[model samples]
Target chain A: MIATKRRLPLPLAALSTGFVLLWVFVAAFPFIWTVWGSFKVEQDFFSRDSWWFAIEGTRTIAQTGSAFTGDGYYGAWVLRDFFSSVVNTVIVTVSVVVVSLTFGTLGGYALARSGYRYTFWLLMLALVFRAMPHITLVSGYLLPFFEMNIWGYMPTAIIVLVAINQPFTLWMLHSFFLSIPKDLDESAMVDGCSRFQAFRLVVIPVMWPGVITTGLFSFLLAYNDFAVTAMLLSQPNQTMVPKIASFLGTIQQEGNVMFAVAAVVSATAPLFVLVLFFQRQIVSGLTAGAVKG
Target chain B: MPHRAFFAFIMPSLVAMLLFIALPIISVAVQSFYVQHERVVTEVETCTPFAGCTKETRVDAEATEKLRNEEPLGRFNGFGTYLDRNHLAVSEIGAILSDNAGFKDAAARIYNLPFYRALAFTLTYTFVVTPFAMLLGFCIALGVDAIPPFYKGPVIFFSLLPMIVTPLVGALIVYWMASSQGILGATLQTLLNDPTLSLKSSAAMTWITLLVYGIWHNAPFSFVVFYAGLQTVPHDTLESAMIDGANRWERIRFVVIPHLMPLATFVGLVQLMDNFRVFEPIVGFSAEANATSLSWSIFNDLRGQVDQLFGSAAATSMLTIVGVIILLSPVLVRTWRDFNRR
Candidate 1:
């Protein structure tokens, strides 16, 4: 039902196709280059003599007797103990997704179902909370957490992330709940089920799609977080993004920028897969706010 | 839902936001009024057999620790930290203004102040990136809409990569490619035949690069939203515009854009909020030498080498929050009006 009843003039069509292709190249090239470059030795990937050396892997061949090498990955995942960070990241993201979704769905459902003025105020407050820079919030947390002796623990980071994640999650899930026909729960409520029971019996089963979409975002927030994770989590409890950041500090001097490159690629792999599998949901989730507003 | 049920459902989330989000602002406000405790000192005299006694003053470490332990919030200075050079620099700005220097010189001097410098970059970045990203995304959405359906999915998947990836990693990828030894840097040098033309070599170049990165990072979001909005545009409106002898551009100008206006506002608001908190790119690009943001300045304070400047960080946080409120007030007022209308 696009307004393509009349074809674009030839020149305009060509120009648009060219523009789209150019955008595709711009969007995709860096990752493609970086991923390919990550497998090569530093000398080749960052070849001073010729860019072709990156593709040919000349230095890599010379150093490791192959056109490709896993040295960067090995150095990062093993020698630098990036594995522990991966474990930490898994723990953080999972816990954040679970806890935030639990709280978000409950709050979002209430906000969607209620016909009160204060609900609007609550959401407005959330909008303000959402706008608070994560670093600003971290600044507030640091002194108190340090004083409470909860400064450098995984649980503290997890809880802080849940709170930080709450605003956006609530907004998304609130909109999602609005899209769900309220009568589904209201009818169940009229049949003698309590609100919570109606929510569990009727809404919970159909809520998974929205829940999963919100969970993807929550997972992303926890996984991609640098400010809170970098500051709040102590060295051993550091997540992947912070660990990658920490890698840049220690490894650059050792001429192991490739380790950082490799880690970046590793860090991005899951997100790539997430988009691959959940592109539609991701798109819907993004447009859900804009379209509704 | 009744009030009790609604409260019960929202209580956990409310408690979390209140404890973590609302209370922190108050804590930051309180902390901003206080500076770290001054080290206690004592005058000491020691006498030996061979020499006359010499009086010495030493930092009383035990006393200082005891004082700090007794009051971890430090001593209240009541806005002193806010006015200090590292923060708002009220006195410094006043001195610069009173100097009667030419506008350029005075402007340069004020820009050299850390807080003003960060604020300038942050605002410049937000204002510059938002519109460009929206425009670029609109173009891409138009292009995608014009493309054949067969390729849309893959094209979208590729497009989403930049936005969906971690911000720090995305910035790192761009930074790596733009670094001196990286491919893009080398190609640009070879193309321009100016070996010294490096993106990181100057402040202007770094700012331009960051603006470009910002556009790149943000455009996909707007593209996705706009594309979705495009799909929902009414066919009848376009047909009627065509029947009215409107050209393709006219149809788009009159029909498509109007349909997408609200979505554009949404994108603009979200982008403003996100761009105002530009921190990751600075860290990822290691651009601290040339550029910083309000968020980055706060991070720098907390990560100070000697000791964490809690008071200074809190002051900056409060100021940043104020800036957010200023930036968001118009939108808030409009939304309130809309809600009231509803």
Candidate 2:
């Protein structure tokens, strides 16, 4: 009886694992291919050199012939508009992180600790912007921006990027801050910290980790966006996504160019995130915020 | 934070959002009533240079200039944008509104046909991606939580891989992979022994790739969220569940899942919203692809067409946004109570 009982959950766990593995397999190849292909040059790209080989000699020579091992990353990064991609990515990502955090934390804080009756309207307002298809936003804005030169000076891409990144942080960090009891703030105020001081000195320090996690997501999401970059930028000013898309048409085009840069770009934030999340408390905040939502 | 300064701290985001997001919505709304300039520029540089290498040239300017000379730029003709682009006399929009027979037949048609279809597409898309993403996340949470502590960090980080990246990149990656000529295209084709795989059909390609892609991108995020939820499970509830001889699934389903109901609901609802407006991937898939949803089609009318019709596209978008708000109401109502309580 016990054996039969234990077996029931086994299949569920296994099924879940199978699902995870299937997704992982699907997710891994393009990423790995991106890394490998980035090393090969144009001649190799056209030769269908993207096709993998191991232990074979002649084809590998032809494939590896034009591949410059030493400077590929540097070429993609500092030389071949990669530096600009990094700059654009950084500018957009950093601004998004700061702005989204402010909105999310404050919005979430209001949602969490307020007696304000209109908070529902505010929350739903967030959902409206969050839920709307970004393409619709892109489509609607293009004509107006073209007609009205006021927004012309500012890069339209950065503006949309912020809008897109805002909802998630609001959702994630709202729960994070809300979970902290109102009494905690009340007590901080009682201890003579002004409400602002209580938030800054008391509550903020406690929720700093949650803030970091949300900020990390905002920065990363802004950096890697394709459609925004593709639509917003001119070719010379392309961020990583448009750059990747240009490299993306076919195996006939340079597929490896995307793969290599993606590998590098995707790897950047996760490294810092992993380091920051080493402590269990912060790591769990992400799950808590997401799960509770 | 004091209420006043706290409000002040939040003002920057609010202002940025208002200018970029809110005003754009208003601008689009206003512009929707006016016709878009139909200038066919002969020699604008292609932003994506790789897609073009031919000498620059032009033709359509003749028609636009003639039209402009006859009438001032941005002149509006009533309700034409909604129907003309589809090349359908009474598109599904007209068919739906025709039932009303109360409003002008044209107004009825525009709202009923295109508006409903756009709403359906957005709702279906969001509903499809959200819960499953949550499930995938919760499973990851279970796995990482079960593991020895050191392994959690690496696994969690990797799982979050998609979450950390932009949604646009996620779509691009999937588009590249699912294409017949992409990196894994050959592999999948080889596995099937057919020159064509599922990518041959546009909608099928979207569903398969988008679903899998959504999971791949979201599982780690969901895991992190669910894991955090798991941490907050009061010990008393767990002890009680164990004492009752409740299995882990029973504990999770009864005790744990209930606690996450608010969360699961929110994530599910949000994902529903995200998916409903699922324009980028379809657009990314290409013009040749037949899987264009109502949103993508409406957008094409405004921006992606031989003729740009700004008014009707904006109207349709407004209608679509309204539908999403309706869908969000139940969750917003509940969250409101929490926001108000002492």
Native interface contact recovery, all models: 0.83, 0.33
The local lDDT score (0 to 100) that residue B173 gets in candidate 2 is: 56
Quote the positional error of residue A25 for candidate 1 in Å: 0.6
Q: Tens digits of per-residue lDDT for model 1 on B58-118?
A: 9999999999989999998998999999988999999999995699999999999999999
The DockQ leader among the candidates is: 1
In angstroms, how far off is B24's CA in candidate 1?
1.0
The lowest-lDDT stretch of 10 consecutive residues in candidate 1 chain A is A1-10
User: What's model 2's overall lDDT?
Assistant: 0.60
TM per model?
0.98, 0.74
Residue B234 lDDT, candidate 1, scale 0-100? 95
Docking class of 2: acceptable
**Best prediction by lDDT:** 1
Show model 1 residue runs off by greater than 4 Å: A1-6, B46-53
